[model samples]
Target chain A: MAAYVQDAIMLLGDSLTQGGWEAHGFAQRLSYVYARKLDVINRGLGGYQTDWAIPVFEQIFAKEHEQHHVPKVRLLTIWYGANDASPAPSPQHVPRDRYKTNLSHLIHMVTSPASAWYSPDTRIILITPPPVNTYQWDGRVFDATKSYAEAVKEVGLKENIPVADVWTEIWEAAGKDEKSCERFLSDGLHLNAAGYEIIFNTLIKIIGENYPELHYDKLQNVFVPWSEVNVADPRPSLVKRPAMIGLAQL
Target chain B: MAAYVQDAIMLLGDSLTQGGWEAHGFAQRLSYVYARKLDVINRGLGGYQTDWAIPVFEQIFAKEHEQHHVPKVRLLTIWYGANDASPAPSPQHVPRDRYKTNLSHLIHMVTSPASAWYSPDTRIILITPPPVNTYQWDGRVFDATKSYAEAVKEVGLKENIPVADVWTEIWEAAGKDEKSCERFLSDGLHLNAAGYEIIFNTLIKIIGENYPELHYDKLQNVFVPWSEVNVADPRPSLVKRPAMIGLAQL
Candidate 1:
């Protein structure tokens, strides 16, 4: 097995994060800014509600960690709610009461000592679903999203985790300009490149202010600098002893 | 070390591959298309010449394998030549003879028995640099890129590896219109989203036709479907004997 490991930050959510994987995309921006320092893993599952993801999270975080030699996860951004906010009739929708329960359970399962994937150093940031442009999301009810976002915020506060309120952040970034929502949400739901930009920038700023240690400049690259590479023996550079302590269950 | 290993496909190249990490980017498409099947790794280094990468290659591939547990690398794409095409005065430029030598060295090192990283079943593809709109890339002499591309094809032919001649393919895909070049390149040098779309589609098609086993439908996600998940007993899904035997040096 290869020994190279980078501290990873996970983007856990739904289609918004999936769409954020594009060029100039949200995850891509973080990747660009953080390059060798940390790998931004996109765990975004399109069309998924929080309920389905709970088990998937166990696989990716808990079970996977129990089995695989993947990198240590340093920061996990739990961004969900888009699909959960679907109308009650939609299969993707989760009832408001259950939604809050799911979010609260998710936070505790991942961060609490009662769970298998818990690591004291691993920071959890909950992100609410971004504001929806109703016309583009099959006439999705915008109020439903706000309510779900509120649920996420409540869990973040009760769980003592940081939160990136992309829902409010995106709308405010759009300002009073008419149709500016179009600039942010390409299909009134999924964000366009511009919409992701605001989210990406905002998250980076949040990390800088609240999780300064995770900042790009503060972290080390996976390997030695090009100048320090041993032209005659370069293997040592990529094989720095992995700093996995406190980062992974391993 | 983490025991779970994800089969990986490495995109080894320069800026095109690096920039290709964007939304609907080449690697992202592979990630989406191959989710749960194989991990698509971006080993793209910007502003790198093949010579500089040769040792770094050993560092990333061979030594790291000797030290840690990484998922097996089932497929690797060696895409280079863009930076090498920089004019004679540029530090990034390598002489024509040396460029071919470097490409040849790279192919053999990764594929032949002389290297520890070599595995007979590991598929290797050589991707020539994409079409360079001469006026956009420093008004570069077009013939230079064409020559380097031809050199890559020759190596691929001699080594019996697949070659993606993006330089020719993109141009033809654009239908040879006078300014069709503009549609494929964002800065007369790098590709825009439209151009990447064609590359992403073509690569997927190539995998379908040539590397059918690498197709998405044929692969398995890293875990069991949520329905089959034990909920009470989840580790078995992730600990399944790794399919890494024929895939990595490990």
Candidate 2:
């Protein structure tokens, strides 16, 4: 069994989030930078919408009693708008109003003390889905997704959660032209490496600005550096320590 | 807190393994393929030797009594020898005999029934360190490193564990030319994307042959596919399921 040696950064949402494990994707980049500091637990379910995600989140996020045994989720990224923005009649679609409610509900599951999954230590950053390239795919409308992205920001504001508004960031990167989004979107829906690079950079900047303590540069490896390991008496030095560089250690 | 929804593949070793979280590295590739089926927990500590790793492993691997509370380690890859091959007098150096013993000790910690961390479900693959480009770096000697690689093979043979002979694979890929190995190695020490690609493919092949049941293709997602979810009553469908496709389910 894997032990709770390090806390985790859990990425939760749809295909956009699941694809974060791809090379050069945001999740992979985060894992590389936060290598020894935190484990990246990807709870991204491809093709999932906020409506369907609520129940899944309930099961995946440990209840209060189970928390003592599991790794703490130091950071949580809830990125969902993409699939939920699908036009009505598409099974993946969640109405914009309901989408906002679902996002908030997911957030409160951790932020609200009354909820079974509450964890005050878990800092969250909500992400708005990237812009769609209408010319490349017809599964979604550019405007509809834009509305869903807008809905996400509203929820973030109401919940006081930091938002990684990749939708607007990608839109401007594409010169506000939907077709130009092809440079970032592989199939007009999913992201390419270049697209994910933007998400990774945007996310890191958000971490630095809002949760600087959790920044990779600010955290230490849970295990001591090789040179620092006491060679003559290595066992004591080898025990896993907290990743945080406390004032005492400093 | 993160719930244990999936089993895991734990990668344990030195810088070579730590670097696996980098883009296009073996860890990222495995996480991509095994996305929903199994979470990839990286326990790779940089600049670590088999000697330093044992104590670290004791804390990072859950003991038998604690196993029920944590995620099962379905697969483990022990890749060491790069730093240990450092010449005598270097702090990182472990005599060839002791290096072999340390490697076996790590395997036995999980495989031995009487061991505290014993986990019979965890299948292990022993990976030989990639061939070093002696012309580009003087930290290690080519022949000395080759001897360490041979030692890993001996350990795997004696332990009856599968070995991902990446040393031979990378050497042959470099046309057996020391300087040409720069094509795969970034600084003649750590691997480049091309080098990691070889490790990923070779490891996959070993898994296919030795532990076919654990392959990503054979394992179902712990969560139901969106299309298969019982939409009206998703709570039942959303409950976490084992990744294995049982005979009845098939």
Candidate 3:
């Protein structure tokens, strides 16, 4: 069984977030840096949208009563809108207004004191879907996706959550040219290594700026480093310790 | 808090295993394939040996009483021996005979029903240490490390556990030439992407051949695939389901 040794950074979204496990992807990068500090849980469901994620999140996120039994979600990145921006004919599509409401609902499930899944210790970050490269995939509209990205920012502002605006970041990275975004998008929709590099960097910067205490650099390895291990009697030092710097074990 | 939606593949080992979170490393590859099917929990502590690991594993691996509260560790990979092979002068060194005993003890902790941490559902795989290139690094002797690798295989056989002979695999891949292992190893000790590719492929092959039920291909996503979702009434379909194929929810 997987014990609750370390708190976790949960990434919740669609294929974009699921694909974060790819080599050089944002999830992989976070896992590397947070190796002994925090576990990164990728909850990204491919081809799913805000509407569908609502029910799934409810089942995956432990409620207040179940807190002690599970690992604390110290950091959560809600990256959606990619599938929600799909055309009207697509089942994945969620209208911009509903998308915003769904995003807020997911956030409130943890942030709201009255909610069943209230977790005051969990810090939330909202990530806008990357700009769609319509030329590469005809499944989505460029302007439509851009509007959805805008909606994500608006929700972030209202919810008072930090937002990693991947849309604007990639848009600017591509010099605002839609076709040029191919450099980042693997299939006009999902991100490639270069695109994930941008997401990882932006996400880390946001973590450093907002949740500095949770940054990998600010934390210690849950176990003492090798050289620090007491050779003659290591059991005392080998016990799992808290990663938070200067924080005594509870 | 993270709910126990899917079972997990827990990797327990040293830096060689902790480094698996690196780009193209075994951990990342496993996470990608097992995305929704299973969660990959890396309990890899860098610079750790079996001596130090026993205590840490006791704390990290859920005991019998705590099993219901945590994710079921369907597959557990026990990879160690790199640091333990250090020569007599080094504090990390654990003699070959004692090393074998330690490995067996770790296995018994999960397999032995009498043990406090006994977990019948957890399947274990033992991986030997890679060959050391003395020309590149003086920290470990080539023959010394080879003996340790041999020790792992002996333990695996004595315990009737499958062994992923990484030592022999990489050594053969290097054409029995110690210096040529540089292609796989980043430094003389750590693995690079190429080295990890070999580990990932080997590990997956072991899973496929020995534990096909737990293989990524045979398992279904905890949540139904997006295309299969019931569009009109998705809540019933959105619930987290077991990943084992043809197996009804318990």
Model 3 chain A worst lDDT window (10 residues): A241-250
Compose the digit string of candidate 2's lDDT tens values, residues B113-202: 999999998999999988888888887999989999999999999999999999999999989898999999999989999999999999
In candidate 3, the residue pairs with backbone N, CA or C atoms under 3 Å apart (3 or more residues apart, or in different chains) clash, namely none
Model 1 CAPRI quality: acceptable
Answer with 1 or 3, whichever has the higher TM-score: 3
Give each model's clash number: 16, 0, 0
TM-score, chain B, model 2, is 0.97
- Which stretches in model 3 have alpha-carbon errors above 4 Å? A246-250, B248-250
- Give the candidate number with the greatest TM-score: 3
Per residue, candidate 1 scores C-alpha lDDT tens digits across A45-129 of: 6776787777667656643344244566778888889888888776677788888888887777666776676656567788888
lDDT of 3 by residue, A1-250 (tens): 9788898999999999999999999999999999999999999999999999999999899999999889899999999898999999799999999999999999999999999999999999999999999899988899999999999999999999999998999999999999999999999999999999999999999999999998999988888898899999899988777888776672
Q: Over 4 Å off in model 1, which ranges? A: A1-5, A62-68, A86-97, A133-140, A173-183, A217-250, B1-6, B35-37, B62-69, B86-98, B108-114, B131-135, B138-141, B170-189, B216-250
**Model 2 ranges off by over 4 Å:** A247-250, B247-250
Better of 2 and 3 by TM-score: 3
Error of 2 at B174 (Å): 1.6
Which one is best on lDDT? Answer: 3
For model 3 chain B, give the 10-residue run with minimal summed lDDT: B241-250
True contacts recovered per prediction: 0.21, 0.82, 0.89
